[model samples]
Target chain A: MTAMQEGAHVPSVEESDEPKMRDVFSDVPTDTGLATDPAGVVIAELGDADPRILTLSADVGVTLAEFRSRHPERYIEMGIAETNSISVAAGLAASGFVPYVFSMSAFGVLKTAEQLRTGAAYNRLPVRLVGRLTGLAMGFFGTSHHAVEDVAVARAITGLSVVAPADAQSVISLMRATVDREGPVYIRIAEDAQPVYAEPPTYRPGELLRVREGADVTLVGHGMGVGLALRAAARLAEEGVQAEVLDAAWLKPFDAEGVVASARSTGAILTIEDHDVVGGLASMVAEAVGRAGVAAALGSIALPDERLEVGVPAQLYERYGLTVPNVAAQAKALLGR
Target chain B: MRVDTAPPATTPAPSDGDDGGPTLDRGRSITPVELARRADWIRLQTIELIDRAGLGHYSSTFSSAEVFATLYYRTLRLRPSDPAWPDRDRFLLGKGHAATGLWPVLADLGFFPTEWLDTFGTAGTALNDHPDMLRAPGIDFSSGSLGQNLSVGTGIALAGRLQERDYRTFVLTGDGELQEGQVWEAVMAASHYRLGNLVAVVDANGFSGSGPTSDAMGIEPLAARFESFGWAVREIDGHDPEALLSAFDTLPDPSAEQPVCVIARTRKGKGVRMMEEAPQAWHLGHLGPDLRRQVVEEISGRMP
Candidate 1:
C-alpha cells in the first residue's frame, strides 16, 4: 500500500474513519471488503491453466512482469507495431494456440482495432486481447493513453466479446469463463480499483450480478463504475434512500434480461461508466430498457465526447462524474430526491 | 496505351533460349516448358473465373501466375492429400487481389473440388475478393488488407520454433504493398528474431490498384531496402518459375539465423496481351467474350 506511507503528510480530502485516506490514488486502492490483489495480477491464471496459451506483448508486456517470469516459455515480446502485433496474435491463434495480446488500452484496442476486426474477429480466431490502463486509469499519461472509446469500438466487431472488469477478482472471473471460450475477446482491465468482492468470484456473461440490493432505485455500473456505485449505495442508505447497485457482468453479450428486470423493479435508474455515454454500457442499457418499455426514468453519468486531461487519478475521476459522491448525487437526482 | 507489346524484356528466372523460347535447364519433375504451360493454364482459369463473376483482379492475377506455378508445383513442400498438415510449409498471398489466380492452383493440387470455383464471388460463396483459410483448404492465413502477411509469416515462423515444428513459411507480397508501415515492422521483427525459416517473395508487378507502383508511392531500391533491414536479398524475373525455384534454392538455411527476401521483379500483366499493354485500365476490368477469346488465343499461342 504505497498510499498509506505518504498519505499522512498530504492533508486528506474529507478525512475518513478508515486509516490513511489518500485521494491521490497511489499503489493501494481504497479497500471494498473484496479479497482482491492490488497489482491486477490474476491473468497469470490463464498462463498456468493452458499449456497452449501464449502472451503477446506490443512493448507493453512489462505490465505483466509477474506472468513473464512465471511462464517464460509462453511469452512473445512484440515490437511497437500495434497492427502487426494483432495480426501476429491472430496467426498464433490460427495455429491452434490461444494468444493473449497485451498493450495499453489506447494502443491495443483503438490503434489495432482494424486488424483485430479483420484478422481475429472476422476470422473467429480465439485471440484474447487484454487491454491495460483502460478508461482514465493512465491519467498522468495524457488523453492519448485514456481508452474512452474502447468498449464502443470493441462492441462493433462481430464475434468479439468486450469485457470490462471492476477489479482484479472480476478479471480472474472473466478469464476463467473465457479461458476455453471460442472466438475473439477484448478484456479492458482496470489496473487497480478497491477490492469489492469478499472472495474471488467466477462469472458467466449471461448471468448478471447484483452487488448491493435495494428497492428504491437502480444504479447500473460497468467496469470500475461498479465500485463507485457500491460506495454510492452505502452513502444513499444513510439518507434513507435505498439504491440497488449492479455490475454489468458482461459487455458484448450484455444482460438485457437483468437490465430490464432491474429497471422494472425500481422505477428510476442511473447508468454510469468511465467511458463515453454514446456507445458504452449506459447506451446499451438505456436502449434495452427503452425497447422493453419498462417505464423507468433512466439517466447516465459518463465522459464528455472530448479529450480528457492528465492529472492524478482522483482529480480526473472528480472532473468526470466517476466518483462515489458523484454517483450518489446522480442517483438522488434520477430519483427526484 | 500499349506499354510493351513485345515479350516482357525481363523474366524472373533467366533462361538460355537456343532459338524460339525458354528451354528446360533442369531435368526435373516439372520442366521449364511444363512450368510455363501450367502458368498459362492458371492464367486462363483466372480470366475464366473472373469473367464468370463479372468483375475481378485480372492484371494482379496475371502478373503472378508463374509465382503460383513455381511455389505449389516446384518450391513449396505440401501434402496435397493432407491440407491441415501442421508440418507443411505455409504460403500466404499478401497482395490478396491475386487470390483468383491461386484458386485454380489449389484446386489443381486437389485441395478442394474444382466445382468450388463456380460459386466464387457469389452471395454465399467462400471465395471472396481475398483469401480465407477457413473456407479454402490450402490457404495458410486469411488475408485481404495489405501489410499484414509479413507479420503473420513472422509469427508462423516463430510458432515453428515454439511448437517445435520444422515448417518454413513463405509470403507473396505486392511491391506497392511495402508502402504499408506494418510490413516494415514485420521486416524488423523477422530480422530481430533471425527467422531463417521465413522467406518473403515480393511480386514486383509494378502496379497497385490505382496505377504504377512507382507513380502511386515509389518504394524504390526494393532489394537494397530489404538488405539494409538485414534480410538476405535476391532479385529475379518474377515470371520465370526457373528463376523463382533457383532463388528459392539460395534462401538462407533454417539454422543460418538470417531471413531471406527474394524480390521477384515482374510485369503488371505477364500473360494476357491487353493487360500487359494497358498499365492502368485493366487492373480491374471485366473480360468481355470477344476480348476473352482473343486473350485465350494469345495465351494458347504462347504456350511453351
Candidate 2:
C-alpha cells in the first residue's frame, strides 16, 4: 500500500514500544503504515461502486487526484471557489446526484457557510462536504487556514450532520456509513494519518465509540484528539489511574445517553478536542451533562479562545497543552488526584 | 397576519378581455403576444401578493416577470405533474426576493394549487419572500442569499453533463446581485467547464435596495465581463417578450462547448408608472389599496 506522500504526518498513539505518553509524542513516527490518501481512496471506491457518486474539488487536488484519475468523468474541479462549489454540490444533489465537495476546512465551512446553510442544509440535499486540514494542522499557515471553529458553525446549521474521523480506518468506516444519510453532511479531517482504530468499525451518527473502559474518569475526544486521548489514557494507566476513552466521531446527533452513562460510571469527565474551548466537544458535553443533571465533575482541555501563533504542529500542540501528558494531567485534575 | 387560504385574486390563465379568449395556459409554448400578457399578469399578481403580505421587493420582482414568464411559458421543458422529474430543465432565481413573482407563475403551471399563492408570508405558509424548495414544489432549489443560485444552476448543468442527460439549467440573477463575488466565481466555473447546458440571465434593472446598482457597486460592462470569462454573451430588453423569446430561441444547443448568458437590460419597475419612474423608492414597500388599484389598472392597460 502506498503511504501518504503529502500533508502533515500524524503519528500513531497505539505504539507498543513507548512506555511513557510524553516519549510517544516526542518520538513522532515518520510513518503510520496507513494507505496514502485514505479519504480519496474511499471516494474512488465509492465512485466505482455507485454511478450516482460525483466528486468536486476547490483547487485542493492532491488528496483527490486519485479519484480524478479513476473517475475522470465524475470529477469536477471548481478552481479555488469554495463558496460556489458548495452551492454547486447542492444543485447536483437536487438533481439526483450525490456530490462530495472537498476543500480546506476553514474556507469550506466558514467562508462558504451561507451557501452550506441555505443551499444544502436548508434544502435538505445529500451534499457531502469534506473539509481537510482541520484544526491547527496547517501549523505554519497562520489562523486563516486553521479550522478550530468549524464544528460550531456546522452544528448551528440545522439538518447538517457534523462528523470528525480520527484515522484512516475510521475515515473509510464513517464515509461509507454516511454516504446515503439524509440531508447534508460535513466531514472534518486533519492532515495526518494514524491507525486510531485497530480494525474498521461500524459507525452510527450520534453515538460515541468506546475505545477504552475505566472506572475513575472518562476522556472523551474527537478527530485527532481521539488518538491523543488514547495516549493519555495509557499514561494514566501507568500511574495506576484508570481513564475511560471515548471517540466522539459524530458531533451532531451526539450520544447524550452514552455521555451520561460514561459520566455515571466514571464520576469525572474531561472533554478533549483540537477545537476552541467553547462551542465544540466540550460545549456539546456540557449541554448534555447539564441537561441530564449528571453530578459528574466536568472539565475540558482545548485550545484557548485567542489567536494561535505560527509554528510546527507539535510545538503548537505542546504550547496549547494538547500533548498526552497535559491531557492526562487535566484528566487527573478532574479526578482531584 | 391573516392565513388567507383563498385562491389569489388573479386568473390562472389570464383572458384576452375583448374576446374572452384564454391568452396563456400551462402549455410549454406560447406566442409572443401571449407571453406579454402573462408577464403583465405576473406583475399584477406580484403587486397583489405583496400588497396582501404587507411588504416585499416589488421593483426586483417587476424586473424579472418577463424573464420568468418567458422561461416558464416558452423555454424550460418541465413535467408539471412530476416536479421532480430527472430530465426536466431546472430554473433557480438568484434574485430570490423577487420570489413573489415566481409564486404566481408556479401556481399557474399547476406545480401547486393556485390557492397556495394566497398564503404568501402568512403564518405556516410555504411561500416566503425567499424561495424554499423544501416547502414548495416546482422550485428547483431554495435561494435567498444573493449570488448562490448561479452556482446551484451550474451544479445542475454539470450533473446533467456527467449523467449524459440533455436537460438545461437556467438561473435568473439581478444586476444588483452581480456585486457579490461568488457570482463571478460561478461565471468562471461555468465557462471553464464549458457548460453549454447552463444559461444565466441577468436582470439588468440598474437599481438595488439602496439606489442604482452602479452607485452601490459598479458591475457595468456586464456583457464584456461575461465574455472575458468565456461565456457566449447577448444583451436584450428584459421587459420585451419578443426580445426575451428571441434570446431563448437563439440559445445554442446543450452540446455546445460554451455556456450562454443573456444580459437582460430591464427597468426595475417595468409596468407601473409610479414604480417605473422611482425604482429606488419602490425597491421594497407596502402598496396600500389605492396604489394597488392604480398598479393593477396600469398593468391591465398595457396587456396585449
Candidate 3:
C-alpha cells in the first residue's frame, strides 16, 4: 500500500504494532446530563427553566416539534427559508431573548452566512446556530446536506465561535455554554444518535478534554470522531500500546496550549475529524502546533478532498478510514511498531 | 402646544437663485436655501470624486446625490463619528452603485477623512466600487448585489421595533433592482411583521443597465405596487431637495398602520445637462476631457 505522507513522517500500514488496553470509560462519571446516557437528568434540567428556550428549525422541523411540545411559544417553524430564520433569530436576540436557530448544516451556515456575518458577528448579537446532520451525518442525503465546510466558514468570521460536540452530554453542555457566551456561535450536531463519550466534568468551549492520557501516541478528535478515537484508544491499550485520547470540542479559538502540552508530553499526535482534512480540525491543529513551535509528528484521519460517494454511514466511514480499527492501525504505524 | 397643520404647497418652479444661479431651495419652508446650497456643494464634491477616480456608477450616483444630501444634512438623526450609535435612524443604500454619492456624503458628515475620497478605485483603498461595511467607516451593510439591501434593512427595522427603539430604517432601491425576487420577499416580510419603523425608497430613475426601465423590465405604477404590498406610499420629484425633505419629514407613524414607501421619480443623471437624459451606457462611462471641463463650468455657473 502507498504510505500517506503527513509532515516529514510516513507511517506504513504493514509495519504497525498493537497498543495496550486502558479502560478510561470506568473513570468517566455516569451522572453526566445526557439524552442517551441519562435521559431523566437532561429532561429534569430542561424542565426547571425560568423562561423556556426557543428552538427554531428550517424545512425538516424535526427538533422544532420536540422543542415546541415543551415550549410552544418558544418554538418557531420558519418553513423552508433558512436566511429569514437567521435574521429572525437576530431580531429575537436584540429583544434579549436566547434563540437556537436549527437547520441542516450546509444550508444553515452557507446560505445564511451574510446574516451571520452582519446581524450576528458585526452586530455582536448572541444567537446560537445549531446545524444538525453535520459532517457526513446525513450519509444518504448526498453532498448538498453534508456540512463538512461549516467549521472553516464559521471560524473565518470574526467574533463568531464554532463548536462541535462529540455526543449528547457534550451537546447539552455546549448548548448551555453557548447561551452563557455573549456572542454568536455555530454548533454542529450529528444526525445519528452516537454513543456518549464525554464524562461528568462536561465539555467547555475552548477546553480540550483528555479522555485517556498516554505517553507513546496521541489521538486527537472532535465531534463524532471523539467517540471513534476513545474506542480506538481502548483497543490500542488492550494490545500494550499506550495511546492518549483528546476530545477537541472547541474548533475555533482552538486550545493551542492544550494541544501543545499534549503533543510535547507524547512525541506523536494523530488528529481525526469527520470533516474534510483540508480546512477542518486537522489543518487547525497542525497550524496551531506549527505556530506554537511544537515538534511532534502529526497525522490526520479525515475525509479526503474528493467528493464522497453515496453509501450507508458505517460503510462510507470505514471506506474513508474513519473507523476505530482504522484509527488504531494508523496510530500504530505512526509509532513504527 | 397644539400645532396648526398647513395645506401642502403647489409644485414650484425649479429655483433660479436671487444671485443668478440654479435656485437651491425654492418655495421650501422647512429646509432653508443655505442648507440646500450645502447639499449642492456636497453633490458637486461627489461628482468631482467620481470624475477623479476615473471610475464609478456616476450616472446613478448623481441621480441619488440630492436624496443622500437631504438625508445626511437635513433629516436623518445620525452621529457620523459614532456610526454604531444606538437609537440612530438607519439608512441603507440598496443601489450600492451610488457609493460614489455615499462616500462624499459620509466624508462631508466627517465619518472618515475626506482625503480618502481621492484614493477611490485605487488598489487597497477602502472606497471600492461597492460599499463594504468592513472597508468603509460608515457603511451599515456591504451591498453590491442588488436585492439584498432591503432584506437587511428589514432586519435592522425589525431590530429597532423589537428593542422598542424609536429609530427608523430607510432603504433606497433602484427601480430596476425591484426585478429581484428577494425585494418582494422583504416587502412581504416587512408588511407581515407590521414593521412601521421601515421606510423603503424607490429611486424611480426610469433606467437600468440596458436602457429605460420600461424598455428593460417595466417597473411603472411603482407607487401603487408598494401600496398594494401594505405600505403607505408617497410619490415625489426626487431631484427636488425640498420635496424630498417634505416626503421624509411626514413619515408614516409605525403605530398608525403600515410601513412607508417614498417613490421618488428622478432622471438617471439629474444635475449634468449632457448626462441628465443620457443612455444607460453613460452610467459608468467617464466624461471626456472637453465634457468634463464643460460640466465643471456648468456647475460653477450654477453656484451662488
Candidate 4:
C-alpha cells in the first residue's frame, strides 16, 4: 500500500499502464450469445442506446481499462478510495451521466453506505453500483472481505433498488434495467463462474422468475443460491415431491405478490440465501408470507449469525447449510414429507 | 434586479426599511441591519418551532446565528426556487447541531414555506434534529456524524473542478468533532488535490459534550496543524459578523496551492445571557418561559 504524504502533491496514478491480471474463469468465452451476457450482449445493447454507460472502479483498474479500451471516454479509474468513488459517481449522475461504480461489495456498498444514502437515494441521483465478489465469493479473503450484510443494509435504505443476479445472463439483464431506471440501484455480482439459467430477455427487477413450477412446496432463492434452489427442486422431483423454484432477483421492493401466490399454491415454503438469516432474503420472504396471511410452514436455509472462520467458499457454503441438499432437506422437513 | 455586492456596515444600528441597510466596502459582503433584523425574526421563528416540538440544538445554533445570517442572506449564489440547480454553490453543515439555525435561514431564503418551521421535529416533519438533504430544501448533503462532511465536501469540490464549474463549496465543522480519523483523511485529500474552491470553517466553541475541548481532547494549536496539512489557515472571532465576513471574503484564488480553513473561536451559548457561558449540557437544555422572555428582551436590545 502506498502512503500518501501530508502537504505533498500526490500525482494521479495511471491505471492503464499497470500489468493485467488473468480473469478467474478462462473456459468462459469472451463472447456469450445471451443478451445479458458479459461480452457482446449487454455491451452491444448499451452500444445501441446512444452509448451512455460510464464504468468506474476502485483498485480493479484492469476491468475498467478493458471497458475503456472498448468504450473510450466512458470509463474512469477512481483508484483505491471507495467513498470518493461513490460520491463522484453521484456527482456524475447530477451532470446527466450514467455512472456504474464497481468495487468490492464490502467497501463499495457498506463502507460508503452514507454517501449512497444521501447523495444518490436521498437526492434521487441516477447511479448504478456494481459490487463484485458479493457474499462468500471472496472465500479465501476471510471475514473482512465477505459482504454478508449488504442485502440488509441496502434494504434499510429507501429509494435504493437492490438486485442480486444469479448468472451472467441475469447480470446483463439486471444491469440493462438498472441503467435505464431513474433511481439508485445496487447490483451484487459473484466472483466465481455462474451457471447460465436463461437466454435472452428473461430477467427484470421486482419480477420473480419461476424457474420450476410445482404445488407441493415453494423454494425461493437469490444470487448464487438460485442455482442451489433449482438443484434442490430437481432432487425433490425425483423423490415424487414436486417443489416450485422462484428466483428472487430483486431483494428490495421484493416480489411480495409472487411470494404470496407461491406460498398459497404450495402448502410449505423454504428460503435459501448465502447471507445471514436475521435480515436477509429469509426474513424478507417470511415478512411477505406473514403479511399475506398465508398458513404455510416456512423454513430458511442461511448462515447462522456468527463470524465465519476462514475457508474455501464451497466448504463454507456447505458448512452453513447453503448447499442444494441442505435446502432440499429443510424443505422436506417443512413439508413433513 | 442586480443584487447588492456591498458588505453590511459595522455601525451597530438598526434599520426600518426592508432593502435599505448597511453596506460594507470589503470582504464577501455581510447582511445589512435590515437583513439582520429579518434574520433575527427567522431565528425567533426557529426557536419557537424547536421549543414547541421539544427538540433542537439551541446553543450551537445560536452561536452561528450571525454566520448563518450572512451566508444565506448575503453570500452564496443559490436558487431557492430550484434547490437542485447544477451550477449552484454547495453549502455543507458539518456540525449539524446548527440545523435550527439553518431552518430559518432556508425559510427566509424561500427554499420552503416559512410556516413549515412550525413542523420542525414533529412526527413526519421534514425538519429534524440533524439536516437530511432528502427531507429539507436547500441542504446539499445530510450530515450529523462528525468528520464525514469534509470528505463529502472534498468530493463535491473535486467534481466542480472536473466539470469546470465556478461554484464554490463550503463546509462548517465543530472544533470537538475534528477528532475522527476520517477528518484527517479528508484534510489530506483536499489539500493534495489543491481544492482552493473549498473553504472549511471550524466553529471553535471550546466545549464538547463533556466539557471544553481542551479538557476533552486538547486540539490546541489548531491553525498550525491545518497549515502543516497544506491548508491556508485563518483565525477569527466567530461571534463578530465583520471578522466572519472578512474571512469569507478574500478567499484564495482557485489557482493557489491549497484549500482554506477558518478557525472561528466562539461561545457555545452565545445569545441567552444566563446560558451564554454555561456548560455544554446547556447546549440542548430547554429555555423556560421566564428565560425565553429574557432571551427575547436581550436579542431585541442587541439588534442595533
Candidate 5:
C-alpha cells in the first residue's frame, strides 16, 4: 500500500526509469469499443435530454464536470458524503427530479447500503446510483478502495436494480434505457473494461447478452469478467475447444432463465467475475442452476474470500486466477477436455 | 383526581410583532390558543393509538406533540384535501419512532381516512411504527432510520429550488439522532448548497431510548454546531406555541443563501405527569385500563 504513495513524486511513466505500481498494467488495453469517456460524457447527454435529470457527485465532481458546466443548476457537488448523497437523491426523486448519484464503488454501495435500502429502495424512488472504478480498478489504493463486495451487497437490496456494464457503450445504453425506470438502479462500471460491444446493443435489465456462441462450455461474466470471458473463449478456440460467453449484466433481476438454458445446453458453466466468490454472479448462477435441477458441472473464477493482495488490477487478477489462461483452463477442466 | 406535579407550559405571549419576515401558513384562521389545544389533543390521540398498537415510543411521541401541532396547525402550508399538491410545503420526520404524534394531525387534516389510525401497527395498516410516504398520502418521505431525513429534506429543498418553486421543506429531527454521523453530512451539505428553503427543527427533548442524550452521547451546544456549519440558528421553547410561531415567522427567507435550524428546547413526555417525571422509564411502556383512563383524563383536563 505504501509503495504507491512512496513513488508519488514520479510524475510520468516516461520520466521514471523503473516501472511503478501503476505502470504494471501499462500494456492493458484502454479502448471501450466506444469512443467516449462514459463517465464524463454520457451523463451530461442524459441531463441534456431530460430537464428533470439531476447529477450529483460525491467528491468525484471531475467525472460530472461536463454536466455541471452544461446544466449548472442540475449538478450538485455533495463533497465526500456518500450516505448523504443517496438520501438526498431519494428526496430529489421523491420531489419529481431524477437524480443520479455518482461515486466510487467502494463508498457508493458498501458505505451507504442502509441509506440506499431504507431511503431510496424502500421509497421506490428513481435514484440512479453510479459506482465508478468498481472492483480492483482502483489498484494500489488498496482494499479500502476496492469494491469486490459491492455486487453482493447491492443485489441483496430489495428494490434496487444491480447492473454491471461491461464497457462504455453498455453504460450509455443502460443509462438511456433505464432513465425512466420506476425504482432505484445501481450501475456498476469498471474504469479499465475492454471493448466487448461493437455498438450500443439493445439492453434489458434482467436479460443476458450472449456475446459469443459455442458448445464445449458456458463462460458467464459481468463487468470486467465479460472481457476475461471473451479472452478465455478466444484462447479456448485456439485449442479447438469452443466456449460460449454470456454477459450477466443485471444481477438483481438476474437472468435465471438464461442461466438455466445455458446450463442445459452446454452442461458446463464457468462463472468468471471481478468480485468475491461468495455472493456475486457465481452465487446467483448457482442458485438458478440448483433450483432448475440442471445436471451441469459448475465452476467459477473469482476473487477468493480472503484479504486481497494490494497491487495493480492486472497483478491481482493474475494472482487470483482471473486471467484468460486461468479461465480457459477452468472451462476446459469443467468440460473434462 | 387532579394529581399535578410539574407546572403546565407557560401561557403563550400576545402575537403582535411584525419584522416583515416571511410568514408561514399566512391567512390561516387557526389561533395560537387553538393550536396549543391541538397539541394536547394530539397527545391524547397518540396515547390511544399507541395503546392500540401494543408497543410504541410513548415519550418520544409526547415530546414532539407540540412541535407536530405547531407545524401542521399553524406553520406548514398544506392542502388537506390534496395531499399531493406539488406546491405544498414538505415535512419529514427524522425521529420516525415519534410518528404517532404526527399521524392524528395528518388524519384530521384529511390526508387519509381517520380509520387507518385504528389499525396502526397491525398486519394490514398503512400506519406503522414509522411514517411511510408510499402507504400514507400526507407523508413527504418514509423515515424510520434516524439521521437520514435531514439529507432527504435537503434534497426536497434542492428540488424545489431547481424547479423554481417556493415550497419549503421542514425536517423534524431528534437531538439524539444528531449523534449519527450522517446528520452532520446533511448539515454540511444543506448549508453548502445554500438551501434556504430547508429548515431542520431539532426536538431537543434531552432523552433517547437508553437515557439522557448527554449521558448517551453529548450533543450540547447544538446551536453553536449548526452556526459553525453556516446555518442560520434559532433557539426557542418547543412547547410554547407563541415561541414556535415566532421562530417560524423569523425563519430565513426561502430565497436566502443559508439554511435554518431551530433548536426547540423541550422535555420528553410533556403534559403527562408520570412520564415527564421519569422520561427514561416512559420512553416506552404499557399502561393498563385504569392507568390509561387516569392519564387520558389528566391530559384532557389541560385542554381548555
Candidate 6:
C-alpha cells in the first residue's frame, strides 16, 4: 500500500540486488490493459452532459482529476470514509443530483456495504459507485487492496446495478447508458484490461455482446476477464476449436437471455473472470444457464477463495490459471477433449 | 384525535437583531407555555406508541422528547401539509430508535394523519421503529442505522448551499451514535464545505443500546471533539425547550459558512423516573400494562 502511494521511490525491506517482489514483475510492464483512465475521463464527460451529475471522491479524488478540474463545484472530496460518502451521495441523489462516488473497490463495496444497502440500494438512489482498480488489478497491494467479492457484495443489494466494463469503451458506453437511472449503480473500473470491441459498442443493459462467434463452445468473460477469455478463444481457434465469446457487462440485470442462447447454441460453457470462482460472473452464468434448462457442460475458472500470493497481475494470472492458454485448455476440458 | 392536515397559521416572525442572522421557527405563534405543553404531549405519545409495539426503545425516545417537541413546534421551518415543500427546513433523526417521539410531532403538524401513529411498529405500517422516507412522506431522510443520517444531513445542507435554498438541515443524533466513525466523517465534511445551513443536535443521553456510552466506547471530551472537527459547538440542557430554542437561534450564520453542533445534555427515559436511572441499556423494551400505567402517571404528574 505504501509502495503504491509513494509511486516511484519505495525502499526495499529485504536485502537483494534482484528483488523477487519488484524485479520479477517490474520488467513485465504491469499491463492492466486500460487504454485510458475510465472514471477520470468518462465521469467528467458526463458532467458536461448532465449538470445535475456530481462526482464524489472519498480521498481518491486524484483518480477523478479531470472531473474535479472541469466541474470543481460539482465534485465533492468526501475524504476516507466510504460509508458516510455513500449516504452523502444518497442524499445528493434523493435531492435530484446524480452523485458518482469514485472509490477503491476495497473500500467502496466491502467497507461501505451496509451504508450502500441502507442508503443507496434500499432507497433506490442513483448513487453511482465507481470501484476503481477492482480485483487484483492493483497488483501486489495484497488482500486488503484486492476486492474479490465486490460483485457478490454489491449485486446482493436489491436495486444496485453491478457493471464491469471490458475496456475503456464499455466504461464510456455504460456510463452514458445508466447515467440517467434513478437507482444505485456499481461499476468496477478495472485496469490491465484490453479492448474487446473494435470501437465503442452501443451498450444496452441486459444485452450481452458477441465478441466472437463459433459453434463449439461459449467463452464467458466479464470486465478484465474478457481479455483473458478472448486470448483463450484465439488460442482455441489456433487448435481448430471454434469458441464463441460473450461479455457479461451488466451483472445484476445480467444478460441471462444471451447466456442461455449461447449455451443452447454452443452446448458447452466456460466462464472466467478476474474475480473469485464464487458469487461473481461464474455463479451468475451458471444460474442463468441452469434456469434456462440448457445442458451446456459448464466449467468455471476464477481465483481461489483464499489469500493470494503477492505478485504482479500477469504473474498472478499465470499462477491462478487466468491466462489465455489456461482458459483455452479449460474450454477443451469442458468439451471433454 | 385526528391530525390537522392544514398548515399551522404563520406566527409573527422573530424580530431581527444586531447580528441579522436568519431566524429558525422557534415556537412561532405557539407560546412558550404551549411549547412546553406540546413537549409533554410528545412524551405522552411516545409512551403510547411504544406501549402498542409491545417492544420498543422507550429510553431512547424519552431522551429526545424535548428536542423533538422544540424542533417540530418551533425550530424547524416546515410545511407539514406539503412534506416535500422544497424550501422547508429538514430534520433528520440519526438516533432512529428514538423516532417514536418524533412520529406524533410529524402527524400533529399534518406531515401525515394521526391514524398512522396507531400502526407504528406493526405489520404494513409505514411508521416503523426507524422511519423511512420512502414510506413516510414527511421524513426528510430514513434511518435504521446509527452514524448515517448525519452524513445525509451533510448532503442536504450542502444542497441548501449549492442551490441557495435558504432552507436549513438539522440532524438529531444520540450521544451513543457519536461512537460510529461515520458520524465524524460527516462532521469533517460539514466543516469542509462550510455548510452553515447545517445544524447538528446531539441528544447526549449517556446510554447506547447496550450500556452507558462511556462504558460502551467512550468518546468523552465530546464538545472539544466536535470543535476539533471545525464545527461551532454549543452545550445546552436538552430537556429545556427554551434552552433548545436559544441554541437553535445562536447557530452559525449561513454566510459564515460554518456548521454548528449542539451537545445537549439529556437523560435516557427522562420523564419516566423509574426508567430514567435504570442502569445499563434500559434503552429498549416495553413496560407491561401495570408498570406502563405507573410510568405514564409519574411522567404526567411532573409536567408543568
TM-score of each: 0.90, 0.90, 0.75, 0.81, 0.92, 0.90
Q: Which ten residues in a row have the lowest lDDT in candidate 1 chain B?
A: B1-10
Ranked by DockQ, the better of candidates 3 and 5 is: 5
Supply candidate 6's per-residue lDDT for A269.
87
Query: Comparing chain B with the reference, what is the TM-score for each candidate?
Result: 0.89, 0.90, 0.86, 0.87, 0.90, 0.89
lDDT of 3 by residue, A1-337 (tens): 1122233222233544422222211222233333232222332345347352456567645445445567665555666767777766765564456667877787899888877877677667777788876776666557775677788788889889888877777776776666667678898875343565544347656879888879889998888788888888889999988898898888876888888888898978888787877788888888878998988888888877778755445546656777788888888887887
What local lDDT score does residue A279 receive in model 3, on the 0 to 100 scale?
83
RMSD of each: 7.3, 6.8, 9.7, 9.6, 6.0, 6.0
TM-score of chain A of 1: 0.88
Model 6: residues >4 Å from true position, as ranges? A1-35, A291-293, B1-27, B279-282, B302-304
Cα lDDT tens digits for candidate 6, B206-249: 88877888987888899999999898899999888677778876
- Report the alpha-carbon TM-score of model 6 versus the true structure: 0.90
**Cα shift from native, residue A29, model 3 (Å):** 19
> After TM-score superposition, what is the CA distance of residue B29 in candidate 1 from its true location, in Å?
2.1
lDDT of 3 at B34: 45
Candidate 2: list runs displaced more than 4 Å.
Answer: A1-32, B1-29
Error of 1 at A206 (Å): 3.6
- Model 6 agreement with the true structure over A157-250: per-residue lDDT tens digits: 8888988998877777888889877689999876667767655678677778888899999998888778788888888889999999888887
Worst 10 residues of 4 chain A by lDDT: A1-10
lDDT of 1 at A144: 73
- Number of the top-ranking candidate, with lDDT as the measure: 5
**Steric clashes per prediction:** 5, 1, 13, 3, 0, 7
For candidate 3, what is the DockQ-based docking class? incorrect
DockQ of each: 0.59, 0.82, 0.15, 0.20, 0.80, 0.65
Candidate 3 local Cα displacement, residue B230, angstroms: 4.7
